[model samples]
Target chain A: MSKLTIVANIKAKADKVDLVKAELLKLIEVTRAETGCISYDLHQDNANPAHFMFYENWQSRELWQIHMNNQHLADYVAATEGAVVEFTLNEMTIID
Target chain B: MSKLTIVANIKAKADKVDLVKAELLKLIEVTRAETGCISYDLHQDNANPAHFMFYENWQSRELWQIHMNNQHLADYVAATEGAVVEFTLNEMTIID
Candidate 1:
């Protein structure tokens, strides 16, 4: 049980990008229904209306740290404070 | 000329990971060299052993179409056949 990949590079506020893309599509469908989620995808940057990407997969890393302490992604990160100017997170494996 | 984003998910055989990785390093460099390319990042799932992604952005679609025709990438595709188990590509736009 060691499958976990989470790559997120979110930057918003190019005129609020349609209210942060409708709150990131309900936060990627509630993080793909948690519980060792296998996939959760979200993307943007058709010219960078404030670049964004959140492609995730899990089955380990302690269930992705309990899906980042659930609670609706901590209330959608406190309702997207400041609309997230910039963020980055990357953890990957599988060298082939 | 608007912005464009390209995300590619490439998979490789669980065993042949090393060899292809080296070849890919060069491929990515060349693609990134394209005149309009803004970003091109590659990633793989930690547990899947046969899952990957390629995140890319360009200034416009015309240049990206040309990039697809680049000879080097054509060659890499030929070099790794069975090793790739699954692949996917996504196109996105900022909706906010």
Candidate 2:
């Protein structure tokens, strides 16, 4: 299990749903192009559209850390600063 | 945006790590051949090897529910009953 995976659950403010969604979707394309990126996806709760989750796989924890500090991610975070109401992050590794 | 995704976090009892892992990996091959399964991946925690997470994608929620009631899944559940210590599940839709 060498992959560094990330599962991040996030909630957006009611009024900022569209804005938050656009930014999250942008992460998929941008992050996937970054070095060491294996997989990057975004999911939303069907019952609660404002609730979202990020599913990502990186080559290593160190690379993931670099992704966390990347300018694109930082920009997304900055763009959605207060729009996100709540978030929970989980860092994991592949079990296969 | 139509995909039904599953994020299940599970923890195996300290002594049952190997047993739980075998069963979890078995799911990948078995589930992938099922009707609507798109992607099925298994992951563990770097700090806690016993901790596992399932990242799955299905064509539809109905198909995913059918998978939940499938015999293979039922058997896996039965096989690892006591080995799993804690679990949390989240059902979501792809945010495209």
Can you list each candidate's DockQ?
Answer: 0.21, 0.62
Please write out the lDDT profile of model 2 over residues B5-90, one tens digit for every residue. Answer: 89888899999999999998988888899999998889887678888999988998888999999888889999998899898888
Q: Report the lDDT tens digits of candidate 1 across residue range B41-70.
A: 776655554566676778988898899898
| Candidate 1 residue spans exceeding 4 A from truth | A1-20, A25-67, A70-96
Clashing pairs in 2: none
Worst 10 residues of 2 chain A by lDDT: A1-10
lDDT of 1 at A28: 73
Give chain A TM for each model in order.
0.34, 0.92
**lDDT, residue A67, model 1:** 83
Q: lDDT values of the candidates?
A: 0.73, 0.86
Report the number of the highest-TM-score candidate: 2
Quote model 1's TM-score.
0.59
lDDT of 2 by residue, A3-77 (tens): 688888889999999999999888888788888999888888867889899888889888889888988888999
